[model samples]
Target: MFFKSSKINEFRLWGLLFTLFGMGLMILGTSGIVFWGQAGKWFAGVFMVIGMIAMLLSVGVYFWAGMLSTSAVILICPECNRHTKILGKTDRCMYCKTKLTLDPNEATDLDEGITEKA
Candidate 1:
């Protein structure tokens, strides 16, 4: 299991965006002030509902990521093995900073330094 700051940051960014969007919708829904008469009123209500859903989904994702972070296995890279966590897809060795790939074929294509015995 490896945790990368970049990936974490990416998740955080998405979570924040979702929450903000959701809040915006909720506020609009509550306000009930239409910008464009009856036609626009329906759209506003819809946006608010969708925003609420997005916020809820984002919260779930944040929780899931946190759980995964705690459960992931830690390994020392043989090449640059400095205690890095590997997640799904592909990861890099933290110590020597070797790029790690999940797929054996892709790893082979990426670099000769990569070994895919696992």
Candidate 2:
């Protein structure tokens, strides 16, 4: 299976990517600046629509990531034995894919959750 980072880290990385994508779109939309008046408005309008969409999406992603962070639980990775944070009911080791458990009743390898292990 492909390696995956902890849920929290993935969210953060996604948020950063969304922000950059929005900024890039906004920059591209401003290409009309060179033409000054004639074509600027038309180009700016077309670019602005797409750019605004990207920026709004980025803002939403950032907000969601921030909200998700509030519930993240800090734990020690079993494989690497290093301290790391994981989100949701299931998660994997930040450094290594060793299974972890929050509840004593449940088995170490949870069938469903965010991460595969601690």
Candidate 3:
């Protein structure tokens, strides 16, 4: 609840984290030359490979998120009146973080006390 985010946004956030981590690794790899002279080439190569793998994984995550976004149901949030996308039966508003659900049963349950408002 403290870190609520729409499913799509969560995916994007993870992708971004992966990208940043990969870039960091690549930079660290390149810096190996400054630390170990000629021997650093092997260390750099290994880190660079790992970095590339992370970058590729990020690309895949982004692609998956994009595909999911295309199919997500867009709805207007009752609390903020802003448009938000819902990925499943339950999700939070992208802007207001209001608890949302497509199921009527869940709605009542949320209304009882579990719902989160902006």
RMSD of each: 7.0, 6.7, 4.3
lDDT of 3 by residue, 10-45 (tens): 899999999999999999998998899999999899
Candidate scoring better on TM-score of 1 and 2 = 2
| Model 1 residue 28 CA deviation in Å | 6.0
Best by lDDT: 3
Candidate 1: how large is its RMSD? 7.0
Query: 1-55, model 2: which lDDT tens digit per residue?
Result: 1337667667667767777777776677687766576768778787777877777
- Evaluate model 2: give its TM-score: 0.66
Model 2 Cα shift for residue 89 (angstroms): 3.3
RMSD of 3: 4.3
Would you give me the overall lDDT of model 3? Answer: 0.90
How many pairs of residues collide in each model? Answer: 7, 7, 0
How many clashes (backbone atoms < 3 Å, residues ≥3 apart in a chain or on different chains) does model 2 have?
7
Q: Model 1: per-residue lDDT, tens digit, 2-62?
A: 3444354456567788888889887777555555666667777787779879999889879
Would you estimate the TM-scores of all the predictions? Answer: 0.50, 0.66, 0.89
lDDT of 2: 0.71
